[model samples]
Each structure stands twice: as C-alpha cells, then as structure tokens.
Target: MSFLTLLDYASVLVFAASGAMVASRAQLDIVGFAFIACLTAVGGGTVRDLLLDRHPVFWVADPMPIVLAALMAVLVFFTAHLVESRLRWVVWLDSFALAIAVPAGTGAAIELGHGPVIVVLMGMATGAFGGLMRDVVCNEVPLVLKQGEPYVSCAMIGAMSAITLVWMELPLNIALLVCAAVTWASRASALLWGWSLPVYKSRPPRQ
Candidate 1:
C-alpha cells in the first residue's frame, strides 16, 4: 500500500474515534454511534473530493474507511465509560486526525497538479471540516467556529509548510512527516496552554 493510502486510513480511524466519543457522551445508541462515526470519517474528504471534481467519492471507491469507522464506533460504544474525560479525549483525537488529514489532502492535491492555493485550501478543509460536521451534528460548537481557536490556522500552517518543503525538493514522505508533526504540536500546545488567536473586538457605536 502507498504511504498516502496508509495516512488516509489512519486519519479515518482517529476521526472515527473522535466521533464515537462524542456519540458516547451523548448517550446515543449503536446506530447513532455508527452514523456519527461514518460522518466524521468521510465528511471532510467528501467535501474535498467534490470540490476537486473527483468522481465516485473516496469512501465509495474504497469501503474500508466505512468499515473501519463502524468498527471504531462499536468499540467506543462498549469502552467509552473507561474514559473519564470523554470531551477532552475527543478534542485530542480530532487534533491527531487533523494532523494526518491535512497532509493527506495536500499531497493528493499536489499529485493532481493543483496549484499552491488550491492545495492549501484542500488541506485545511480536509483537516477541519470533519470535526466541523461532527460538532454540528453533536450540537456543540465546531472547533473551527469556536472563538479564538487556532484549529484552521494550524491546518493552514502545516499545509503551507508541507507545500513549501515539497517545492524545495524535499521527499514527499519527509514533507508529510514534518507537516503532521507541526500540525499536531501546534494543536497540542494550544490544548495544553489554552492558547488561542486574537478575536475581533467590536467597538461600541458613537452616540
């Protein structure tokens, strides 16, 4: 199997785990767990593929992601209670997924001969939109939409860094590793230190 293919599967697994955690917290049934897990696993990649005009969609082309996601959901359903902090665990898992997915998306775009701008956008979308869909369905604020969160920014930086390194003739595998490391480290730091971007301050209207 290709490295990118492996990355894709890993991304699906982590994202699915995050979704399952959310479903567990919501006290959902097995079916609910499966639904959310599938959604989170493929939601962002689906969007990226559609936007790039890739036919048959990814999960349609390869059913392993679906199966893996469902399996993860079932596993979490039985084991969730062991996790004392479900919400926190979900966030970190999603971050790991983001780290993998961003480079996966960017590499796919680069292989497709897409330009830098499209590559960066696709990378960010792939990393973030899954979590966005997950939170929306779970009735919680999406991390990308949360005030001051550096979620999307982290993806962007990692994607751009990967692209730049590739442009510099670095090996694709090396670039991907650096990208994932940068993305994960940035996100982990944010979570550990409560770091966030500056929010807009609206001024009061003058009388």
Candidate 2:
C-alpha cells in the first residue's frame, strides 16, 4: 500500500482507540462497546462522505477499519482496569486521534474536488463530530460544543491551515504534517492553559 494509505489506516486505528476509551468508560457490554467504538470511529467519516456525495463511505469500502475498531474495543475493554484512573490519558489519546484524522479528512475532501471552505469544514467535521456523537450518546456534554476549552475550534484551524497549504501548492506530506501539528499543539495548549472561547453571559437585572 502507498504511504498515504498506510497513514489513513493509522488514523483509523488511532480514532478507534479513542472510541474504545469512551466505550470502556461507559461500562458497555462487549457487543455494545464494539458498536459504540465502531460508530464513534467512523461516524464522522460517514457523515463527511454523505456530504461530499462520495458513495460507499470509507469503512464500508475497506471493512478493515470496522474490524480493527472492534478488536480495539475488545482489547481496551479487557485492559480498562490499567487506565481507569488515568482520565488525562484518554484525553491525550483522543487528541492524538483528532490530529491524525484531520489530514486524512482534508485529503479525502481534496480527492473529492471540494473547494477550500468545504474541504476544511469536512476535515474538521471528520476529526470532531464522532466524538461529539459519542459524548451525546453517553449523555454527556459534547466536548466540541462545551465552553471552557478549545475543541472544535482547534480542528477547524488545523483543517483550514491544511487547505491553505494545499492551495499554496505545498507537498501533501508537508501540508499534512503542518495540519497535524496545529491540531496537536492547539489541543495540548488548551489542556495546559485552559484556553477557551469567551462565553456570553446575561447581565444582572436592570433597574
């Protein structure tokens, strides 16, 4: 397989690991865990494909991602005890997954002949929406939409930067590296510094 294809598979596995982390935390049964993990790993990609009018979606075409995600779910389920107290580990894993996925998603949009805005939006969606879905399904606030942190904004910036690099005719590998770095650094900074968008607050009652 080509190097890009290998990277795509790596992104899949990383995203699957993040999903499995969520499933384990939710204390789901084996089948439920696999289902949630697979859905969380591929849900965003599937949505992007449908939006871009790309048929067969990605995991559907390969089937390997699903199988790998299921395997990851099983492994994580059995190994949950080891990391049960390490919530930061889960956050970092998810951040890594998002970083890997951003470039892959951008490449997919470029392959589909999407314009820069659409391509960046699609990439950000692919990197973030699955986690949003997982959080919602788990009855928790969706991380991307929550205040007091930089989340989807990081994905958006990374994807848009990648699209800009592509428009500037940069090499694909270099563009991807830049984008992934943007994602990872943004997330890490948010975690370390508590960076977040300002939230609107209603004023006190007027006289």
Give lDDT tens digits, candidate 2, residues 1-207.
654456567766776777777777787898987887887788778888888878888777889888988898888888877874645666888788888878878878887788888888888988887787877887767777777688888898899888888889998778888998998999888988888888876676852
**Per-model TM against the reference:** 0.96, 0.92
TM-score between model 2 and native: 0.92
Q: What does candidate 1 score on TM?
A: 0.96
How much is 78 displaced in model 2, in angstroms?
A: 0.8
| Candidate 2, residue 196: lDDT | 80
C-alpha lDDT of residue 11 in model 1? 97
Cα RMSD of all models vs. native, in order, equals 1.4, 1.9
Indicate which candidate wins on lDDT.
1
Please report how far candidate 1 places residue 20 from its true position, in Å.
0.7
lDDT of 1 by residue, 169-205 (tens): 9998999899999999998998899999999878768
lDDT of 1 at 61: 90
